[model samples]
Target: MLVPLTRQKFEQLIPRIATGDQYRYVWGKFSDFLRRLLASVVAVVVVLLLRWLLGEGFGGLLLPFGVVGGFYWLWGPVLWASLRNAQYRKYKYSGFFRGRILDVYISEELIGREETVNNKGELVYVDNLERRLNVEVGDETGFSIQVQVPLRRSHKGIARRQVAEMIVLSNRADLSNITKVTDIYIPSRDIWVSDYPFLQRDVFVEVSNRIRRDRLESEEESPRTPRRPPQRKEPPQLPRQDREW
Candidate 1:
C-alpha cells in the first residue's frame, strides 16, 4: 500500500521520541533529571565564583541566563525529536507490507554508548558495540529487507515464520535505512519494534485494513483469463463387454 505523506500525515503517523531501547539514550527520567540538576548546580557555582572574583552586579547580570542555560538538558530530547522528525519527513513515500520473519541476524555495532571514568577520574563516554538484532522479512512479492531492532528481552519473543508487517518509508520506492527506522509491527505479538516509534497503532490498523480491502476489490474487479474445461473419458470398453455377454 502506498501511503502518501504530508506534514500532518507524517506527524500523525510518527510518535514522539522517548528514551531507552527505542532510542539510544540513557534510560530513565531520573538520568535526565539528575543531569539537569547537576548542570544547574555547576552553573550556580560558576556564577558564585564570578561574584567573588568580579562583582555582584556582573554575577547578577548572568545569573538567570546561566541558570536557564543549565536547563538546556531539558530541551535536549525535544530538540532531538524535532530534528529527527524533519529528517524523516524527507521520506515522503511509505508503504505497509505483510511478511513472515525469514531469519534473524545477531550482530554487534557501535550503536550504543555508556559513561565511564577515565584515568584522570573525570567522567567520560566511549563507543560501545551494542547487540543489534536484524530480522529478515519477505513477502509473496519476492522482496525482502532486513529490519534492525533493539536487542531487548522481547527479542526472544520474535521467532521465525511469524507474520509481521511494517510501515517502511522511503524517498523513492526502493528500501533504505540501516541505522534508522520508521516502525515494524508484529500482529501475532501485538508489539511494535523499531528504532523510533513512527506508527500510531490504531491508525496503522485502520490503514492496513483499508489497503487490503482496496486490493481485494481491485482483484475481484479485474478480468481473469478463462480456463479450458477438462476432457471427459468414454465408457466404450465397458459397453462392448456388456453387449458381448
Candidate 2:
C-alpha cells in the first residue's frame, strides 16, 4: 500500500523532528548542563594556563574563549536542529509506503576504515564493519525493495513476515529504488526499529491508526476481488545507499 506524501503528514513530522535522537541538544536538561559545566571548567583552566604562559592578559583570553566556547556551546545545537528540520522538509514531499516484510536478515560488509594508533604509537587502519538489518518488503504491485538499516542490538528480534511501513524518499518518482527511507514502523507490535529514532512515537502511532483505518474503509467500499500474494522473488540487488542512520 502507498500514499503520496500529504501536507498533514508533513505538519505532524515537523514537531516530531526535534524530539528525534538525531537532533542533538547541547544542554537539554539539568544533567546536560552539569556535564557541560564540568567540561567547561576544565577547559577554562587549560585556557587560563596557556594565556599566562604566553604573557597574554584578559583581552587575548576573551577572544579565544568566546570564539571556541560559543561555537561548542551555542552554535552546535542550532545548526543540528536546522539540518534535521531541513531533512524533514525534503522528505515531506516524498512517498509513503506500507508493505509486508518478505525477508529479514543481516548483511555485513567493510563499510569503511578507521584510523587508530597502536601501543607502539604507529597509526594503523582498522576495517569498519557495517552490519545492516536488511528487510525485504513488498506491496501488492509485487515490486520489492530491500530496506537496509545500520544494525543495532535492539533489532535482533526482527523476523520474517512482519507488517512494515516507511516514508520513501527516492530519487526516482516511481519509488522503486529508494535512496532514503524513514524508520520502519511495526504497528502491531507497537515497536520501531532504526539506528536512530526519526519519528515521535505517539504521533507516529496516531498516523499509523489513521492509515490503517483508511485502508480498511477503502477495502470494504470496493467489491470483493481475489487477492494474490506478492511473488516470493529474491530481493532486488541495489547499490550501496548513503544513509545517515
Candidate 3:
C-alpha cells in the first residue's frame, strides 16, 4: 500500500534536503521563489520610479501601493507553505511508523478517471495515478513520512520549477515496533529535461497517422457500388442491311 507523507515529517525534512534538491524543476519551487522575489523587487522599483518622476508630491500615494503590492507578493508562498504543512501533520504521528525509510522514489503520476452519471448527479472515479518510483527499497512495510516542496501548478507560467516527493520505509523484521532512519533519498533534486524534444512530437504524429486512417477505413467499408455496365447496342442496322444486300 502506498501513502502520502505527514506534516511534521515534511517540515523536518524540508530543512534537511540538500540545496541541490531545491533546484529540481519538476515541482516548480524554484520558479515560484523567483516569482515572489521578482514581485518584491518590482514593487520597490515602482516606488523608486514614482519618486523620481513625481517627486515628494506623489510619494504619499505611491508608497501605499508599493506596500500593498509587496504584501501580495508575500501572500502566495505563505498560503502554499501552510497548506502543505497541514497535509503532513494529519498523517504522520505517534502510532503510524513500524520502521524507517529504506529508499526514496519519484515519478510522474499518470492520471486517469471515468465520468458517469448517477443518482448523485455526475460522479467521477479517479483510478490510482500510475506512479513510478526512482529507486528500490528493501522493506516498506510501515513508516510515517512527510514531504515538503512546491506544488506543480505553481510553475504553469514559469519556464522552470522545483518539485518533490517523499517516502518513508519501515522495517517489519521485529514485532516490537522500532523505527530507524535506514535510508532517505531526496526527491526534489531530479532535474527534468524541460526542453521539449522534437523527436517525441514527430513520433506521436507518425504513430497516430494524423486521424486519416479512420477516415480511409470508413470510406473503404462504405464503398459505393460500381455503375451497371452500359447497355450494349445493336450495330447500325442500316449499314448492316446494306452490306447484306
Once model 2 is optimally superposed onto the true structure by TM-score, how far is the C-alpha of residue 211 displaced, in angstroms?
A: 1.6
**Alpha-carbon shift of residue 147 in model 3 (angstroms):** 12
Cα deviation at 112, candidate 2, in Å, is: 4.9
Clashes of each: 0, 0, 13
- Which runs of model 3 end up more than 4 angstroms from their true locations? 1-71, 92-183, 186-245
Which candidate order results from sorting by TM-score in descending order? 2, 1, 3
Instruction: Extract clashing residue pairs from model 1.
Output: none
Per-residue C-alpha lDDT of model 2 across residues 147-241, encoded as one tens digit per residue = 67777776766777888877666555455566666778876665576654555557666766786676678679999879899888876543222
Model 1 per-residue lDDT tens digits across residues 156-200: 688888987776666654334322346677777876667655566
Tell how far residue 20 is off in model 2, in angstroms: 4.8
Off by over 4 Å in 2: 14-17, 24-71, 74-78, 111-125, 170-179, 221-245
In terms of TM-score, the best-performing candidate is: 2
lDDT of 3 by residue, 1-245 (tens): 22223334333433322222222222356776788778878888888888889998888878888887777555654455444434433333211111223434345664676666777887766565653433322323333343222224322222211222222323332213434222222223322211111112222233224223643686789969989987986543211011100
Report lDDT per candidate.
Answer: 0.63, 0.65, 0.39
State the TM-score for model 2. Answer: 0.61
